[model samples]
Target: MDVSKVRKDFHILEKRVRGKPIIYFDSACMALKPKQVIDAVNSYYNDFTACHGRSVHYFSAQTTEKYIEAHRKVERFIGAKENEVVFTKNCTEAINLVANGLKWEKGDRVITTKMEHNSNLIPWMKLAKERGVVHDYVEVDNEGKLDIEDLNAKLETKTKLVSLVYTSNVTGATLNASEVAKICHDAGAMLLLDGAQAVPHMKVDVKKTGVDFLAFSGHKMLGPSGTGALYGRLDLLKGMNQFIVGGETVKNTMLSSWEAEDSPAKFEAGLQDYAGMLGFGAAADYLMRLGMEEVHSYEKKLARKLYDGLKAIPQVTNIYGPSNPEERSALASFTLKGMNPQEVALILDESANIFVRSGMHCCHLYHQDVIHEMHGTIRPSLYIYNTDEELDKFFDALRNIAALA
Candidate 1:
């Protein structure tokens, strides 16, 4: 991939913040949207300002056509059919849909990993509380590497689903999707992947992997916020009940009985974010044009440099996850020997205009239980728009920050 050209697409990279250009290293939290996504969102408000479907007005027709195409585009982007993809408010909601929608009995069990974001972790816990279902975990090491043998041991006849992150947002460690899928399937359990961190940074083909469901957010992939998707196997989706019920979710209703719409429509309730959906499609298109394999390779090369630089800093105490960049996404979470993570983050921003994430990174279990760092670690995450020069500046700024340590 042309990294320079990719940086050009993100106009925010061109603008200065507080008298200095931004070296954004927080793509894991939310990716910087490109101009193409921005323009697509703008076109919705500027051109078509009408609701989709059940209307024959010109703008309404335009909205309907665009909405359908958006669905198809995202479906193609994820290697799923148009009918198999359901749009939700975010990945959290998408995960909740599967958690609640799937037919569950009192004794049923759900499995997830210790390294999950709260989005993937909580729903199963709630199910265990409210529905008398069993919720279990596939343990990970201190460095956030999942134990595959423990996963195989956890499966049982009662296990209904195995939900796990395809890639760790905090540590950047990746779960083996295909192997996990086979293990879960062999044990008669459906595998659900929290792909919020994986789908954006790498290629995730659902059919080839045989994962039953995947949930990911558009905002993490340069699409608009408040837009996310759940890709489910068609038969499985057809079997699920609607997670939410509202106007667009039903086909017809009666005083005594109601008929629900098909798979996606049945699951999507109320008015949808038509503009955000279009912008999401556009973002997928942008990534497709750039190529995901190329994106992965570029991030790997940059991450290796980042890993080496951080390792060279004498004040740096820990680098979370594996040392090999190719084994994980382009992210690093580390702690300074004598400095708080928040203090390090503040220094990086004030001194060099760098943006990084600090705190538990939404994985308190990993921090409090595994790494034993309650203050959390400073994380510098990268994307296609990030450059080697940015890494050089990051190292320079970090070295200066280390003097205080």
Candidate 2:
């Protein structure tokens, strides 16, 4: 799918790391921004730098229109209603908003999985102690697959919410979020999905998934950092309490109390990142032009290549996940015998000019379950900008490292 054209969109690829052309394979951590997103941010600063949803001046109105337009674009991208989308600082903040916004009492249960990033896990854990709620975990199999039976078995009357990661950043295994969402709904629980890794690599329809809530970051999807979104069902958002309150999110204020603004406005307090939101809109437009289906196909092809290449290396061992190409993202997690992951990563960066992430990747609990280490796995996540020639070079480097070991 237009690999050369896609590669040209990201200027970062043109630079050299360690005196060699950069070989970035860390999209799961953060993706490189494209020219369109950059220009969008630049245009905002150059032409319009005014407060949004506050003033009636020309630039202010234009700024407000751009901000609202960005939200509309993001809503369409995930197939959700515009009011359902709430802008946040990042995915971490978005998840916390859900965890904090809910009104809970003693004996209320929140179900989650061990495969979640800390942003998805700790919020519930803290809620358990602070609000007298119960936190339940659905265990994953040794092979990194969700134990759907265990998930069903954990359902109970008091369960309030079910939050899960759409795809594991450590194992590269994708989950059937639609099925999980149905299970949660049947149990009278709202399902909230962490879509950090899934949104960029696959198509997601919040309505089709039956999820009540979903969250993702812009930087993971070719946009700038510090921009994220939380999508909640309109009914739920209407009932949920506000997380932040200020000038933009208040309808009226008395000396002792205040009435909060409407759904999305009540959540987004203070001065928001107008330019970043515009850039995120541009990023969404960019991906939509490439087509999510083509993006998914391209990454799966690369993932298959990576899986096959790693499986054939005698000295390398990969963690359990999707063995077939169909069940994974464009990411690989592995360790080399007789070589520490950190050391291997450093050598790759310093000597071979390769960039890869070699740590827990913010999923320490999942790492403990599989690798039994706190530091976690070495992750090499690919994106559309990567090429088959890059994969071949990666294979050669692995072979050389294997010989040294």
Candidate 3:
């Protein structure tokens, strides 16, 4: 990939702070948007601003067409049918849709990993509290990789679902989805992958992985916020209960009764974010044109460089995840020996115009129980738009920071 050309696509890269060019290393939180996505969002508001699938006016018709097309684009991106894609506000809502909508019997078991984000973990915990559902967490190794043996040991005949993160937001460790899916299916359970970190960095084929359900956010993939999707098997979705009721989710309603719409529409209640959907579709198109394999290869190369550079620093300690680039995404979470994570992040921003995440990254269980880091680690996440020069600048800043340590 042409690094300089890719940087040009994101206008945010031109931004300056503290008399220096901004070095954004927080893509895991939210990616920087490209001009193409921005234009697509603007076109929706400028050319066609009307409610979708509710009226017969020209604006409504055009808006609905774009909205439906966006669904198809996302479907193609994730290897799912158009009807299988249900738009949600974000990944959190997508996960909740499955957690709440699924028919959970008393004492039914759900398996998850210890390293999952709060969005993935809290819903199941809530279910266990409200209903008689059983929630179990698989163990993670020191490197933050999920223990397959522990996962298998946790699985039982009563296991209803095995929901896990495709990639760790805290450690950037990528999971073997196909292997996990096979384990779940062999144990007579369904697999649901939280793909918020994986989908943006690598190619994810639901069919190949044989996942029963998948959830991801568009904002982390160069799209607008308040846009995400859930992909569920058609048969499962048809049988599952509706999450939110009212409005476009239903086809017809009487005083005493109501009939819900088909699969995708049944899950999507009320007015949708038409502009955000268009921008998400455009973002998917942009990534497809570049090719996911190429994107993955480029990111791995950058990640390797980042890991090697950080390891060479004497003050840097306890770099999380696998050392191998192919086993992880383009991110490195670590800590300086004596400095607080938040303090280091603030210094980087104020002195070097660098933006990095510092905290537990919402995986409180992993931080509190697994790693036992009370403060947290400094996380520098990368994307296609990030360049080597930016990494060099980061290394320079780190070396100076190390002197203090």
Selected candidate, larger lDDT, 2 vs 3? 3
Model 1 weakest lDDT span, ten residues long: 321-330
Q: What TM-score number comes out for model 3?
A: 0.99
lDDT of 1 by residue, 1-405 (tens): 988888888999989989879999998888999999999998999998898887899999999899889888888888897699999988999999999899999999999887889899889999999999999988887668889888889899999999998899888899788888999999999999999999998888898888999999999999998889999999999999888898888899999878999989899888789889999999999999988888888888987898888888889888998766668678988999889999999999998999999999898877887788899999999999998899999999988888976
List TM-score per model, in order. Answer: 0.98, 0.98, 0.99
Whole-model lDDT values for every prediction? 0.90, 0.87, 0.92
lDDT of 2: 0.87
Better of 2 and 3 by TM-score: 3
User: Compared with the true structure, what per-residue lDDT tens digits does model 3 show for residues 1-405?
Assistant: 887998999988887776668999999999999999999999998998999988999999999999999999999999997699999989999999999999999999999988999999999999999998999988888888889999989999999999999899988988899999998899999999999999998898988889999999999999998899999999999999999998998989999989999989999999989999999999999999888899999999899889989999999998999867668778988989999999999999988989999999998898888888889989999999988888999999999987977
Best-to-worst lDDT order: 3, 1, 2
